[model samples]
Target: MVELAGEILNLPIPPHDEVLPYSESCTDKSVHDLNADNVVLCRAGDDNQLGIILEIQREKDKRKRFSWPA
Candidate 1:
């Protein structure tokens, strides 16, 4: 996975000790809840290394521009 991401991003991604499925929800008390299609958590040892969020959009949605950043 890291190899694929590094190739696509053109940036070196360090090796992670573990990769796990994460919650799809992103919620803030001051803002509306945002849900993604999938979320991945990358960990190195006991610390969190990176978080990957995946949102699958089959059709164009103008609202995605605003919601994606949240």
Candidate 2:
């Protein structure tokens, strides 16, 4: 798993300034509580404007391919 994780980490990383600070993993438990790998949020200060969730796959999983779109 380390190799797989390392491979992912080797990818180009974007600067924090380019992305809003609101972007983070899904951790809220009150509402829908699904631990998302990473979530990109477009926001201005405290206001959350939009979100684009990205799920990581270390290996091939047929279910993930279909579920990721949801």
Candidate 3:
């Protein structure tokens, strides 16, 4: 797993999805909730803004679950 520091953004923000590329191991969420922190976890490709990375998935076996927004 790769770690990075950056903000979280949605579509029509940066319009770049090549920064982080894709994961063949498992699916990834475009935007993740930080819950109590108010922050979010997103792929470098999906993020438009730039923030700092607080944490990352240390376990390679942990396949991230992704879903379509409602």
Candidate 4:
């Protein structure tokens, strides 16, 4: 997964020991639920290396621009 992300996004992601699924919910003080489609956690031993959030948008939604940043 790390290699694939680096290749596809041209990211300089470091090597990780494990890849695991994470919580999709974002902590926000809002009434609406701000949840991503999926979240991934890259770990290098006991340290957390990176977090990747995957959101699949089938149609154009301007609201995503604001929500994604949160």
- TM-score for each predicted model, relative to the true structure: 0.74, 0.41, 0.19, 0.76
For each candidate, what is the lDDT? Answer: 0.79, 0.52, 0.33, 0.82
Candidate 1 on 1-70: residue-level lDDT in tens? 5556668779666678988999998788788888888888888999888787777779888987777876
lDDT tens readout by residue for model 4, 1-70? 5577678889888678899999998667866677888889999999999888877789898987676777
Please provide, for model 3 over 1-70, each residue's C-alpha lDDT reduced to its tens digit, 9 standing for 90 to 100: 1222322432233333333322222223756433221233334555544322233445654344332211
Q: What is the Å distance of residue 26 in model 4 from its true position?
A: 2.0
Instruction: Kindly give the stretch of ten consecutive residues in candidate 2 with the minimal lDDT sum.
Output: 12-21
| CA displacement after TM-score superposition, residue 20 of candidate 1 (Å) | 0.7
Top candidate, metric lDDT: 4
**Superposition error at 70 for model 4 (Å):** 0.9
Residue 47: error of model 1 in Å?
A: 1.5
Model 4 accuracy (lDDT, Cα): 0.82
Model 3 clash number: 4
Among residues 3 or more apart in sequence or in different chains, the pairs in candidate 3 whose N, CA or C atoms overlap within 3 Å are 5-53, 6-51, 7-50, 7-51
Q: Whose TM-score is greatest here?
A: 4
Against the true structure, candidate 3 has what lDDT? 0.33
User: lDDT of candidate 2 vs native?
Assistant: 0.52
